[model samples]
Target chain A: MKFRSMLAALAVLVLGAAQAQEPIRIGSFLAVTGGAAFLGDPEQKTLELYVERLNAAGGVLGRKLQLIVYDSAGDAEKARTFAKRLIEQDKVDVIVGGSTTGETMAMVPLVEAAGVPFISLAGAVVIVEPVKKWVFKTPHSDRQACERIFVDMKARGATKVALISGAGGFDKSMRAQCLQVAKNHGIEIVADEAYGTGDTDMTAQLTKIKNTPGVQAVLNVGFGQSPAIVTKNHKQLGISQPLYQSHGVASKAFIKLAGDAAEGVRLPAAALLVAETLPDSDPQKKVVLGYKREYEARFKSEISTFGGHAWDGLMLAVEAIRKAGSTDKAKVRDALESIRGFVGIDGVFNMSATDHVGLDISGLRMLEIRKGDWTLVK
Target chain B: MSGRTASLATLAGIVLLLPLALQNNYYYEVAIQVGLNAIVCVGLNLLIGYAGQISLGHAGFFGLGAYGSAILTARYGWPPLAALASATAGVAVLAYLIGRPILRLRGHYLAMATLGMGIIISIVIATEDRLTGGPDGMPVPALAAFGAALSGERVWYWVVGATLLAAVWLALNLVDSPHGRALRALHGSEVGAEVTGIDSARHKVKVFVISAVYAALAGSLTAHYAGFVTPAKVTFFHSIELVTMVVFGGMASTFGAVVGAAVLTVLPQALTVFKEYEMVVFGAVMMLTMIFMPRGLVPTLALTLSGRRLPR
Candidate 1:
């Protein structure tokens, strides 16, 4: 039996060698530097590292992966231009990576027109709302984050809430989405307050939320350092009501920045953060642990869910290419849409003709900061 | 050919021949961006290079033009061309009003004033979520004529290329005119220009308005071309980049401004192959160029080609 299995493995390797050919070109444009670097930097690293690993493991469809990344620095025009370069000049078979909704939306027309498959890592509903044929994304939209938070709120019996958001693009978009869906979620936004970008403190806004009567929970709908400051201020003001944050602050840096203030704060994030704690029976355990181990061992940095989005994006493109058995753009696009129950770092995606994002609010696991680390909330 | 005709012919030749060198849509996209930046830099050259005045808020006027055209065509349902014209005209009037008062502040004070103005405009665009779409920005209606949308990189290359040539011709003529000499006179010394019946204040305001108009027109064209506009274009960093292009290409030289815009526009795209070290290499290149050719790219090269000895 051992000898028979060895022979089978040798036969498969030989067949794979025969099928292997040129590298399957994957072009990506990300905001790898400048203002949105937090999102783009990790994403770039994930793509580069995994593509190298896949190539070493005999690649997808016996063809190696070639990833060419351009940093757009969150500039929309540059993103559009880079998309053109990726399509027209690089002649990439598949494209993935857009770190901001503005960048993703800017490239939407060009990719759709050129008949290229693009999977974005940005967060926004507009990219897939009308459901353009060629355009898709990996990151859960801001609406999904809002809905997931509301589910937790509903479970906790929180009816009245106060919304405090920062004046950044993601912050405002998430704030708007939460407001749009609040009534449906059975949550009432009693007080709505905002702060300017680069504001050192958010205590004044926290004070107002605290003063608002019957405010059962205070939701901070923002990302980056602002949310951290919001968390810190919520603790500073000693408001005991549950303080929930958006998926924007899912990274470990949030806990480090907010420190002890982050305790008991709940936000929606991927299960990859608590990979070690996940049961072996969990479907995501294998892939999540593999990704977390590879990234941590290689980069020596704490993993961010932003990087997980890129991992899902690259792997999805690879799987579609494998399913199509060729680099044919249309076939690969169809394969991507038809992919069902494919577990990824983000979620178990089941893409369809109408729903390109695939992962719903359920994909985003509710995680709470406990003892300065993410603890999966049951 | 005369100096004016020679420079214009050289610019026209390159613009005509650029398409052949462009292999595909990607090349055309980069070329289009270069042309747009060149047009704005030409106007900026007139202000900083020839007139010796400074504007750190130049991008504010550019942003206002973009947002103005975007809102008018997309939100109000006006025609694209009409929106572009109105936006440019509005910015010109605004610039005139602003220039009359702020032009009086000489040197660093004027710089500070313009910088503050730019910050204010950026903030307004970022905060005015109802109209400007806040920091996330808004999609713009494409420039169309007679029902056909004027889209695609190939078509835009010619449009922008032709517009750039026309702008150069106008600038070349204006620079050689008495008004041009008046600008130079004021650049030398405001009191000296006024003593010679140059009406330094009037000339300063006129050139400022003209430059602002140029920036506004380019901004509107950019909005329509890309079909998107963000407050990112209106930021202080953008203003600094524009100024750097004017200075880097060689102030007071039209061809230099075009070269600076072209090289800088293409540099970042070309440097992507460097991967992790792209920014470091980019910064190093800029530093070396400034150190080696202190007079900027064009003037230094022009001086050498003419076999002129160094003054010092």
Candidate 2:
């Protein structure tokens, strides 16, 4: 019996080795296991859906793309180690994920040293600006999001505003950019307040904002339940100012978690949410609807701009691998840098060697939650 | 005396040889981090295991060291090594002042006070944008010793391993000495140790300050290696994580602390298979370890080997 068992184990090991040699490996580190799981879980699903679709379409360069994802749990050091393991041990063709700028930045040196093409899902400018040759991003920068929001605000005549942000990497960058954009647009920021990531109550900050004079719009620049808190508090305190949220609050999960308070908040988001509202005659409408339909059909969950970023990231990686015709890091990086007019879920992405952020503010559309449904604000 | 001397020699030998053996840069990076964690855990063991105290606020000291080194070098143009030394010293003094009143509290009260301290530190780091770069974190000066950037992984491995060896040697010697005995007595029975002429409160405070200095040094080293520092490093959860390392390894055993640091650090990497279930698994591990191996991994194993096995 012992001899038989040993023989079976040996056979299984041989088969495993053979199968491992066939797949072209890729890796990413997400926050799937941490408090950020609310975001990372959807990001993971987005990657999985892309991988499935690509593999079914004969994959890139005729090699099956195998994604090996690690959970950084929103910690920076863990992200670094995962990157090392991916580059050194797994020998992946490319890397393509990060849930936050801090976690993404932690792996910058490692990817640069390994000379692999890294596409970040994180939106902070620090991840792409001061761009290393190997790193690229698919998500619109926080600055681009800020510019888009201000464009919509200018249209809405929300010239007087207040800013509130959580104390984290993404929130801080968005806050700074919002202030800068407001300055550039000749609008006034009447009040500013802050909260930590885990703070359950933000009433004090909201109360301060509520009492601030001449504030027409309250811009909440953070993710998770904070946008809802801001909206709820605005109504509870009987503050009549329009609440304009950043793209971080674009998730349906945000509204669901925020309950009834999430109704009527406005924000600038990617074209994904307003697909149904857009005219069939519009050039982007078909692509947006197709992606939304396919993503929803596969995952059975409502997709957000956050997942849209992941889709863009994965599709770009696949395209680069196809163009390079090989998994060599240098070749793949050149392929990514030279990519042009790639119609993505968010926008038409065009990459240049000097500019790593492929998409700009033109990709965003003004959106508002009216009667608990996202609608394109004309 | 012979045992102490031999152990010290062993530590020195390992420190000297580890970098040479770990030619791969990835493992070298891991070694550097393990050394840094060991340094902090040694001090933590002194507090929780020796002095009969608990703290969930060491991340505050850790952050202080990181921010202190970062601000001094980046803002004030101080030399990196000098800044690190000052940072460690500053955290030690802060810990000394804080330990006086907070150490007087017993049990969970002390834990909560320390937790508050960590939260305050992180908040200050996050909010003070102009000074500390806000929550986006600030860049740190590279550790350059006498004109050379300490960029190579092998070089860092040796530097951190040597630091850990020295810390382990000192802690071991301290744990075996008369002062060590007094600490253990206090750990066993604080009132009894006081009754027997030991200055329990003073010893507790001293160990608390020592532990904080160790954590500060570790934090400073880590900041230089990463070349960045964020408020995340100083968060209350991070303080709890450090405490978890000490308790998970075995409070009374220095080897246990090292083992604990290594296991906890590596476990996340191995558990990548679980994907979204990773946190659930990690929480389960913490709960089971506390319930089953309350004395921690090292001491429990030691007891089992010594024919004093705990019942399953």
Model number with the top lDDT: 1
List, residue by residue over A139-257, the lDDT tens digit for candidate 2: 78888888887777777788888888887667888888778767898778889888877787788998898788888888889877767777787778877877888888787777777
- In candidate 2, how many Å is residue A228 off? 1.8
Candidate 1 per-residue lDDT over residues A1-378, each given as its tens digit? 234335536855885676556578899999988989998999999999999999899888877787889999999888999999889877899999889988988889888899999999989888899999999899888999999999899999998999999889898898999999999999999999999888989989889889999999999988778889999899999999999998888887788899999999999988888899987889999999999999999999988889999999999999999899999999999999999999998889999999998997767899988899888898
In model 1, where do residues sit more than 4 Å from their true spots? A1-20, B310-312
Could you give candidate 2's per-residue lDDT for residues B1-312 as a string of tens digits?
A: 896788578767767766565535666677777788888898899889788789888888988998999999999999999999999999988998999999889899998898888888888887888778876677787898899988867777878887888788889888888888999999888889999999987888888998999999999999898877767778887887888899999988887887788778766655555656877898898789889988999889888888975656
Query: For model 1, which pairs clash?
Result: none
> What tens digits encode model 1's per-residue C-alpha lDDT throughout B14-133?
999878777678888988999999999999999999999999999999999999999999999999999999999999999999899999999999999899988998999999988988
Native contact fraction (fnat) of model 1? 0.60
State in Å the error of residue A260, model 1. 2.2
